[model samples]
Target: MDLNLESLGFTKEELQERVIARICTQLLDGVGYDEDDNEFTTASQFHRQMRTSIKEKIEATINAIAEREVLPNVASYIENLTLQETNRWGEKTGEKVTFIEYLTRRAEAYMQEKVNFDGKSKEENGNGYSWSGTQTRITHLVHQHLHYSIENAMKDAMKIANSAIATGIQETVKTKLAEISTTLKVGVTSK
Candidate 1:
């Protein structure tokens, strides 16, 4: 079919060059594949490029789908919580608590539970690392505050004891002096 090339914006010379390339070296004895070796080379290059492009696109699509669909499920599973809200004593309370509220209750319980400072008990029963907000831990507050208070209290106790002892000694001395004066007066009268 003699089709005009001007309609397709192509020149006759360009079409002739393609035709000449196709006519080389291939004898179609029984459907010979290569007109030239360039076809196979071009196909191999196209196959590599197509495989790379498809693999990248497929991986990107899978990642996007996972982010959209699976991540929320994973997050929900991690936060697995009761449908109804409960108080510290496991009784049904007002409204349902969210995950943050649940965690806060747990944190409060952990902090409120009397922290045993007994080193022996800790050595006997300790497990994994313990964590607490520094402000919540009494150990931190006590050490920071009461450590100096103990020394001050001891000093006050010692001062009170010393004052009591001094008062007792003064009273005893006065009593003894009064008894001696009375004995001298009695002896002087007898003389």
Candidate 2:
């Protein structure tokens, strides 16, 4: 009454072993053969981690560029003006004035009140002031320069991040593949 499994090319026990081996291999490789025998790959933890890391890095880079290129220029412009002789004479004789403080106050007043060439106040134009005549030309040039600087910095940061991420991923994949290959070789040799 014993079953002759060998006549079926593989014994029942051998068939079970083969199935278990295939499952173990699929688990290690992170891919499984589907009902159609097509390979389906799963997302690895490393890939998820890389995506999160890249998003954080990009946000930090944008913040850093804005802080470095935009804030200081505005601050410097507020700190460098000297009081005109007419304004100086109009001040009370004994009043001692801090030049930086004075200039900052005056700059703030100008920004709040100044109209652009189009006759729109700074606040009305979304924090952009329009100056008249030569001053208008100068302001436009400065605005253009600042805009270009910030835009260029962002573009450069993106380019650098993309290159770094590409290189990092490539190197990581190569290292992982080498490790897997070495492990497979050792396992085969040991058995």
- Global Cα RMSD, each model: 19.5, 39.4
Q: Estimate each model's TM-score.
A: 0.27, 0.26
Please provide, for model 1 over 1-191, each residue's C-alpha lDDT reduced to its tens digit, 9 standing for 90 to 100: 56689878789998898666654322211122464543433335545566677779999999999999988698686576645767899998777766767788878766555544432123234652563222334465567578789989999999999999999999999999999988885434553
Local distance difference test scores for all models: 0.65, 0.69
Q: Which candidate has the highest TM-score of all? A: 1
Q: Which has the greatest lDDT?
A: 2
Candidate 2: the clashing residue pairs are 116-130
**lDDT agreement of model 1 with the native:** 0.65
- As for model 1, its CA RMSD to the true structure in angstroms is 19.5
Give the per-residue Cα lDDT of candidate 2 at 3: 56
Q: Please write out the lDDT profile of model 2 over residues 1-191, one tens digit for every residue.
A: 56576866798889999999887556555566889889887647854565567779999999899889978787665566445444555854444445786767767665545456654554556754443332443465567788899999999999999999999999999999999988884434553
Q: Candidate 1 regions off by >4 Å?
A: 1-52, 65-96, 118-124, 127-191
TM-score of 1: 0.27
